[model samples]
Target: MRHGKTFGLSLFLLAAGTGGALAQATVVTPLQQQYITAYVAQNPVPAATYGSEFDPTVGAVVPETVVLNQFAVRQEENRNWDGGQDAVRSMLYFVTPTQQTVLVEPGTRRVVYVMR
Candidate 1:
Protein backbone atom coordinates (compact mmCIF):
# COMPACT_ATOMS: atom_id res chain seq x y z
CA MET A 1 0.00 0.00 0.00
CA ARG A 2 2.86 2.39 0.78
CA HIS A 3 4.54 1.65 -2.51
CA GLY A 4 1.32 2.32 -4.40
CA LYS A 5 0.81 5.63 -2.58
CA THR A 6 4.39 6.65 -3.33
CA PHE A 7 3.98 5.81 -7.01
CA GLY A 8 0.74 7.82 -7.26
CA LEU A 9 2.32 10.82 -5.53
CA SER A 10 5.29 10.62 -7.84
CA LEU A 11 3.02 10.64 -10.89
CA PHE A 12 1.08 13.60 -9.57
CA LEU A 13 4.25 15.57 -8.91
CA LEU A 14 5.61 14.76 -12.37
CA ALA A 15 2.41 15.85 -14.02
CA ALA A 16 2.27 19.10 -12.08
CA GLY A 17 5.89 19.93 -12.89
CA THR A 18 5.41 19.30 -16.63
CA GLY A 19 2.19 21.31 -16.69
CA GLY A 20 3.85 24.31 -15.10
CA ALA A 21 6.77 24.19 -17.47
CA LEU A 22 4.45 24.07 -20.48
CA ALA A 23 2.35 26.89 -19.10
CA GLN A 24 5.43 29.08 -18.88
CA ALA A 25 6.24 28.59 -22.55
CA THR A 26 6.64 31.70 -24.66
CA VAL A 27 3.55 32.92 -26.48
CA VAL A 28 4.26 33.89 -30.07
CA THR A 29 2.40 36.95 -31.33
CA PRO A 30 0.10 36.85 -34.34
CA LEU A 31 2.60 38.67 -36.54
CA GLN A 32 5.33 36.28 -35.47
CA GLN A 33 3.09 33.33 -36.25
CA GLN A 34 2.44 34.72 -39.72
CA TYR A 35 6.16 35.14 -40.35
CA ILE A 36 6.81 31.60 -39.13
CA THR A 37 4.26 30.15 -41.53
CA ALA A 38 5.75 31.99 -44.50
CA TYR A 39 9.31 31.21 -43.52
CA VAL A 40 8.66 27.49 -43.04
CA ALA A 41 7.07 27.23 -46.47
CA GLN A 42 10.34 28.28 -48.11
CA ASN A 43 12.77 26.58 -45.75
CA PRO A 44 11.77 22.92 -45.63
CA VAL A 45 15.07 21.42 -44.47
CA PRO A 46 16.28 23.43 -41.50
CA ALA A 47 19.98 23.91 -40.91
CA ALA A 48 21.73 22.32 -37.90
CA THR A 49 21.79 25.59 -35.97
CA TYR A 50 18.42 26.87 -37.20
CA GLY A 51 16.12 28.35 -34.59
CA SER A 52 18.85 28.22 -31.95
CA GLU A 53 17.86 30.31 -28.94
CA PHE A 54 21.37 31.34 -27.82
CA ASP A 55 22.77 32.78 -31.04
CA PRO A 56 24.80 36.00 -30.56
CA THR A 57 26.03 36.68 -34.09
CA VAL A 58 23.64 39.38 -35.24
CA GLY A 59 25.36 41.47 -37.93
CA ALA A 60 26.05 45.22 -37.71
CA VAL A 61 24.25 46.33 -40.86
CA VAL A 62 20.59 47.07 -40.48
CA PRO A 63 19.54 48.07 -43.99
CA GLU A 64 17.05 50.89 -44.51
CA THR A 65 15.50 49.28 -47.57
CA VAL A 66 14.74 46.00 -45.78
CA VAL A 67 13.23 47.80 -42.85
CA LEU A 68 11.26 50.07 -45.17
CA ASN A 69 9.86 47.16 -47.17
CA GLN A 70 8.78 45.08 -44.18
CA PHE A 71 7.69 47.79 -41.75
CA ALA A 72 6.66 50.71 -44.03
CA VAL A 73 5.15 53.55 -41.96
CA ARG A 74 5.52 51.67 -38.68
CA GLN A 75 9.26 52.37 -38.64
CA GLU A 76 8.58 56.11 -38.67
CA GLU A 77 6.39 55.74 -35.60
CA ASN A 78 8.92 53.44 -33.79
CA ARG A 79 12.02 55.50 -34.57
CA ASN A 80 13.52 55.81 -31.08
CA TRP A 81 17.11 56.04 -32.31
CA ASP A 82 18.72 59.32 -31.33
CA GLY A 83 21.83 59.98 -33.46
CA GLY A 84 22.19 56.14 -33.64
CA GLN A 85 24.60 56.11 -30.72
CA ASP A 86 22.61 54.20 -28.10
CA ALA A 87 22.02 50.48 -27.82
CA VAL A 88 18.52 49.30 -28.72
CA ARG A 89 16.76 47.79 -25.75
CA SER A 90 13.59 46.82 -27.63
CA MET A 91 13.34 43.98 -30.14
CA LEU A 92 11.57 44.20 -33.51
CA TYR A 93 10.77 41.33 -35.85
CA PHE A 94 11.44 41.26 -39.60
CA VAL A 95 11.27 38.83 -42.54
CA THR A 96 14.15 39.01 -44.99
CA PRO A 97 14.00 38.84 -48.79
CA THR A 98 14.81 35.14 -48.73
CA GLN A 99 12.05 34.50 -46.17
CA GLN A 100 14.34 34.35 -43.13
CA THR A 101 12.96 35.52 -39.78
CA VAL A 102 15.04 37.89 -37.65
CA LEU A 103 14.77 39.96 -34.49
CA VAL A 104 16.38 43.39 -34.55
CA GLU A 105 17.01 46.20 -32.12
CA PRO A 106 15.49 49.34 -33.60
CA GLY A 107 17.47 51.88 -31.55
CA THR A 108 20.75 50.46 -32.82
CA ARG A 109 19.12 49.14 -36.03
CA ARG A 110 21.11 45.90 -35.87
CA VAL A 111 20.00 42.31 -36.20
CA VAL A 112 20.01 40.79 -32.72
CA TYR A 113 18.74 37.32 -33.56
CA VAL A 114 17.67 35.10 -36.41
CA MET A 115 15.10 32.23 -36.33
CA ARG A 116 15.52 30.04 -39.39
Candidate 2:
Protein backbone atom coordinates (compact mmCIF):
# COMPACT_ATOMS: atom_id res chain seq x y z
CA MET A 1 0.00 0.00 0.00
CA ARG A 2 2.85 2.41 0.88
CA HIS A 3 4.63 1.60 -2.39
CA GLY A 4 1.46 2.26 -4.32
CA LYS A 5 1.11 5.68 -2.67
CA THR A 6 4.72 6.55 -3.47
CA PHE A 7 4.25 5.57 -7.13
CA GLY A 8 1.13 7.69 -7.44
CA LEU A 9 2.88 10.72 -5.94
CA SER A 10 5.83 10.28 -8.25
CA LEU A 11 3.55 10.06 -11.29
CA PHE A 12 1.70 13.20 -10.24
CA LEU A 13 4.94 15.11 -9.81
CA LEU A 14 6.19 13.96 -13.23
CA ALA A 15 2.96 15.00 -14.91
CA ALA A 16 3.09 18.42 -13.23
CA GLY A 17 6.67 18.98 -14.39
CA THR A 18 5.75 18.11 -17.97
CA GLY A 19 2.84 20.52 -17.85
CA GLY A 20 5.14 23.29 -16.61
CA ALA A 21 7.52 22.74 -19.49
CA LEU A 22 4.68 22.88 -22.00
CA ALA A 23 3.47 26.11 -20.45
CA GLN A 24 6.91 27.65 -20.90
CA ALA A 25 6.75 27.28 -24.67
CA THR A 26 7.53 30.50 -26.52
CA VAL A 27 4.64 32.90 -27.12
CA VAL A 28 4.82 35.86 -29.46
CA THR A 29 4.01 39.15 -27.79
CA PRO A 30 2.13 42.07 -29.33
CA LEU A 31 5.33 44.01 -29.94
CA GLN A 32 6.90 41.00 -31.59
CA GLN A 33 3.82 40.58 -33.75
CA GLN A 34 4.10 44.15 -34.96
CA TYR A 35 7.79 43.68 -35.71
CA ILE A 36 7.11 40.54 -37.73
CA THR A 37 4.35 42.24 -39.66
CA ALA A 38 6.53 45.20 -40.54
CA TYR A 39 9.47 42.98 -41.42
CA VAL A 40 7.36 40.93 -43.82
CA ALA A 41 6.06 44.10 -45.39
CA GLN A 42 9.49 45.68 -45.76
CA ASN A 43 11.11 42.57 -47.23
CA PRO A 44 8.96 40.73 -49.70
CA VAL A 45 9.73 37.11 -50.42
CA PRO A 46 8.05 34.77 -52.85
CA ALA A 47 5.08 33.21 -51.16
CA ALA A 48 4.97 29.44 -50.90
CA THR A 49 2.12 27.71 -52.66
CA TYR A 50 0.76 24.93 -50.49
CA GLY A 51 -2.64 23.56 -51.26
CA SER A 52 -5.47 23.08 -48.79
CA GLU A 53 -3.63 20.15 -47.25
CA PHE A 54 -1.10 22.41 -45.54
CA ASP A 55 -1.76 22.98 -41.86
CA PRO A 56 -0.34 26.31 -40.57
CA THR A 57 -1.19 25.80 -36.94
CA VAL A 58 1.44 25.43 -34.23
CA GLY A 59 2.91 21.91 -33.94
CA ALA A 60 1.96 21.12 -37.54
CA VAL A 61 4.86 19.84 -39.65
CA VAL A 62 5.72 21.77 -42.78
CA PRO A 63 6.20 19.78 -45.97
CA GLU A 64 9.80 19.29 -47.09
CA THR A 65 9.15 20.82 -50.48
CA VAL A 66 8.46 24.22 -48.94
CA VAL A 67 11.55 26.36 -48.48
CA LEU A 68 12.23 27.95 -45.12
CA ASN A 69 14.02 31.29 -45.08
CA GLN A 70 16.35 32.26 -42.30
CA PHE A 71 14.98 35.07 -40.14
CA ALA A 72 17.80 37.57 -40.33
CA VAL A 73 17.77 39.71 -37.23
CA ARG A 74 19.75 42.83 -37.85
CA GLN A 75 21.78 44.05 -34.90
CA GLU A 76 19.80 47.25 -34.44
CA GLU A 77 16.43 45.51 -34.60
CA ASN A 78 17.45 42.48 -32.58
CA ARG A 79 17.78 44.33 -29.31
CA ASN A 80 14.42 46.06 -29.74
CA TRP A 81 12.42 43.14 -31.10
CA ASP A 82 13.73 39.91 -29.62
CA GLY A 83 12.70 40.60 -25.99
CA GLY A 84 15.79 38.69 -24.85
CA GLN A 85 14.47 35.41 -26.21
CA ASP A 86 16.88 33.62 -28.52
CA ALA A 87 14.10 31.45 -29.93
CA VAL A 88 13.06 34.25 -32.26
CA ARG A 89 16.61 34.64 -33.49
CA SER A 90 16.98 30.97 -34.42
CA MET A 91 13.62 30.42 -36.10
CA LEU A 92 12.98 30.24 -39.83
CA TYR A 93 10.03 31.92 -41.52
CA PHE A 94 8.04 31.56 -44.69
CA VAL A 95 5.16 33.47 -46.13
CA THR A 96 2.08 31.61 -47.25
CA PRO A 97 -0.04 32.43 -50.29
CA THR A 98 -2.58 34.06 -48.02
CA GLN A 99 0.19 36.42 -46.72
CA GLN A 100 0.46 34.73 -43.35
CA THR A 101 3.96 34.61 -41.88
CA VAL A 102 4.71 31.22 -40.38
CA LEU A 103 7.67 30.74 -38.03
CA VAL A 104 9.21 27.30 -38.05
CA GLU A 105 11.78 25.27 -36.19
CA PRO A 106 14.57 24.42 -38.62
CA GLY A 107 15.32 20.90 -37.42
CA THR A 108 11.78 19.58 -37.09
CA ARG A 109 10.14 21.76 -39.76
CA ARG A 110 7.33 22.19 -37.27
CA VAL A 111 5.33 25.38 -37.43
CA VAL A 112 5.87 27.33 -34.25
CA TYR A 113 3.66 30.34 -34.92
CA VAL A 114 1.53 31.55 -37.78
CA MET A 115 0.94 35.30 -37.95
CA ARG A 116 -2.10 36.09 -40.01
Candidate 3:
Protein backbone atom coordinates (compact mmCIF):
# COMPACT_ATOMS: atom_id res chain seq x y z
CA MET A 1 0.00 0.00 0.00
CA ARG A 2 2.80 2.43 0.87
CA HIS A 3 4.63 1.68 -2.38
CA GLY A 4 1.42 2.19 -4.33
CA LYS A 5 0.87 5.57 -2.68
CA THR A 6 4.42 6.60 -3.51
CA PHE A 7 3.99 5.61 -7.12
CA GLY A 8 0.69 7.49 -7.35
CA LEU A 9 2.25 10.60 -5.85
CA SER A 10 5.09 10.43 -8.32
CA LEU A 11 2.66 10.13 -11.18
CA PHE A 12 0.67 13.10 -9.91
CA LEU A 13 3.74 15.26 -9.68
CA LEU A 14 4.89 14.30 -13.15
CA ALA A 15 1.48 15.11 -14.60
CA ALA A 16 1.40 18.46 -12.79
CA GLY A 17 4.84 19.38 -14.09
CA THR A 18 3.88 18.51 -17.63
CA GLY A 19 0.66 20.49 -17.32
CA GLY A 20 2.54 23.52 -16.03
CA ALA A 21 5.00 23.49 -18.90
CA LEU A 22 2.20 23.12 -21.45
CA ALA A 23 0.27 25.92 -19.82
CA GLN A 24 3.25 28.22 -19.95
CA ALA A 25 3.64 27.50 -23.62
CA THR A 26 0.02 28.09 -24.54
CA VAL A 27 -0.67 31.10 -22.36
CA VAL A 28 1.16 34.38 -22.78
CA THR A 29 0.81 37.91 -21.47
CA PRO A 30 -0.50 40.71 -23.67
CA LEU A 31 3.01 42.04 -23.99
CA GLN A 32 4.29 38.68 -25.02
CA GLN A 33 1.52 38.41 -27.58
CA GLN A 34 2.48 41.75 -29.04
CA TYR A 35 6.08 40.70 -29.20
CA ILE A 36 5.15 37.51 -31.00
CA THR A 37 2.96 39.35 -33.46
CA ALA A 38 5.60 41.88 -34.37
CA TYR A 39 8.28 39.28 -34.66
CA VAL A 40 6.15 37.12 -36.88
CA ALA A 41 5.31 40.06 -39.11
CA GLN A 42 8.93 40.96 -39.65
CA ASN A 43 10.22 37.43 -39.99
CA PRO A 44 7.71 35.24 -41.73
CA VAL A 45 8.42 31.55 -42.05
CA PRO A 46 8.03 30.07 -45.49
CA ALA A 47 5.09 27.69 -45.61
CA ALA A 48 7.07 25.07 -47.43
CA THR A 49 9.49 24.54 -44.57
CA TYR A 50 7.48 24.99 -41.35
CA GLY A 51 4.08 23.98 -40.10
CA SER A 52 1.38 26.41 -39.05
CA GLU A 53 1.33 25.24 -35.46
CA PHE A 54 2.78 27.69 -32.99
CA ASP A 55 5.44 25.79 -31.13
CA PRO A 56 6.46 27.32 -27.84
CA THR A 57 9.50 25.09 -27.60
CA VAL A 58 11.37 27.31 -30.01
CA GLY A 59 9.10 30.36 -29.69
CA ALA A 60 8.11 30.06 -33.34
CA VAL A 61 6.54 27.84 -35.97
CA VAL A 62 8.38 24.55 -35.89
CA PRO A 63 10.09 23.12 -38.91
CA GLU A 64 8.44 20.11 -40.53
CA THR A 65 11.50 17.94 -39.88
CA VAL A 66 12.37 18.90 -36.27
CA VAL A 67 10.50 17.84 -33.17
CA LEU A 68 10.95 20.24 -30.27
CA ASN A 69 11.60 18.35 -27.06
CA GLN A 70 12.14 21.30 -24.73
CA PHE A 71 11.88 25.03 -24.36
CA ALA A 72 14.25 26.93 -22.04
CA VAL A 73 14.44 30.42 -20.61
CA ARG A 74 17.63 31.65 -18.96
CA GLN A 75 19.86 34.61 -18.30
CA GLU A 76 22.55 35.55 -20.78
CA GLU A 77 26.27 35.15 -20.16
CA ASN A 78 29.40 36.07 -22.02
CA ARG A 79 29.61 33.75 -24.97
CA ASN A 80 30.65 33.67 -28.61
CA TRP A 81 27.21 34.86 -29.71
CA ASP A 82 26.39 38.11 -27.93
CA GLY A 83 29.69 38.71 -26.07
CA GLY A 84 27.83 40.25 -23.14
CA GLN A 85 29.22 39.28 -19.74
CA ASP A 86 26.50 40.67 -17.51
CA ALA A 87 23.90 38.04 -16.81
CA VAL A 88 20.83 40.07 -15.97
CA ARG A 89 17.61 38.61 -17.29
CA SER A 90 16.12 35.73 -19.19
CA MET A 91 15.70 35.37 -22.93
CA LEU A 92 13.82 33.10 -25.34
CA TYR A 93 15.74 30.75 -27.63
CA PHE A 94 14.04 30.20 -30.97
CA VAL A 95 15.09 27.58 -33.46
CA THR A 96 14.79 28.63 -37.07
CA PRO A 97 13.62 26.52 -40.00
CA THR A 98 17.19 26.05 -41.10
CA GLN A 99 18.12 24.57 -37.71
CA GLN A 100 19.84 27.77 -36.61
CA THR A 101 19.35 29.17 -33.11
CA VAL A 102 18.09 32.69 -32.54
CA LEU A 103 18.09 34.26 -29.08
CA VAL A 104 15.38 36.82 -28.43
CA GLU A 105 15.15 39.07 -25.40
CA PRO A 106 11.52 38.76 -24.30
CA GLY A 107 11.13 42.29 -23.02
CA THR A 108 12.13 43.97 -26.27
CA ARG A 109 11.37 40.94 -28.40
CA ARG A 110 14.60 41.61 -30.18
CA VAL A 111 16.67 38.94 -31.87
CA VAL A 112 19.80 39.65 -29.90
CA TYR A 113 21.95 36.94 -31.37
CA VAL A 114 22.01 33.97 -33.70
CA MET A 115 23.96 30.73 -33.81
CA ARG A 116 24.27 29.10 -37.16
Question: Model 1, 1-116: lDDT tens per residue?
Answer: 33334333433343354432332222333444453454346444332232323332354335554441232223542364222111111245555545565655454555544565
For 1-116, candidate 2 gives per-residue lDDT tens digits of 34334333433343354433342254666656776677778888999877689877766779988888876777787566534235455668999888889987676677766786
Q: Assess candidate 3 and give its TM-score to the true structure.
A: 0.28
CA-lDDT, candidates in order: 0.40, 0.66, 0.37
Candidate 1 stretches greater than 4 Å from native:
1-57, 68-89
TM-score of each model, in listed order: 0.33, 0.69, 0.28
**Model 2 regions more than 4 Å off:** 1-25, 79-82
Give the number of the best model, judged by lDDT. 2
TM-score of 2: 0.69
Compared with the true structure, the alpha-carbon lDDT of candidate 1 equals 0.40
RMSD of each: 17.0, 10.8, 14.1
Residue 96 CA error for candidate 2 (Å)?
A: 0.9
> Highest TM-score among the candidates is held by which one?
2
Report how far residue 60 has shifted in candidate 1, in Å.
Answer: 2.3
Q: Give candidate 3 misplaced runs (Cα > 4 Å).
A: 1-89
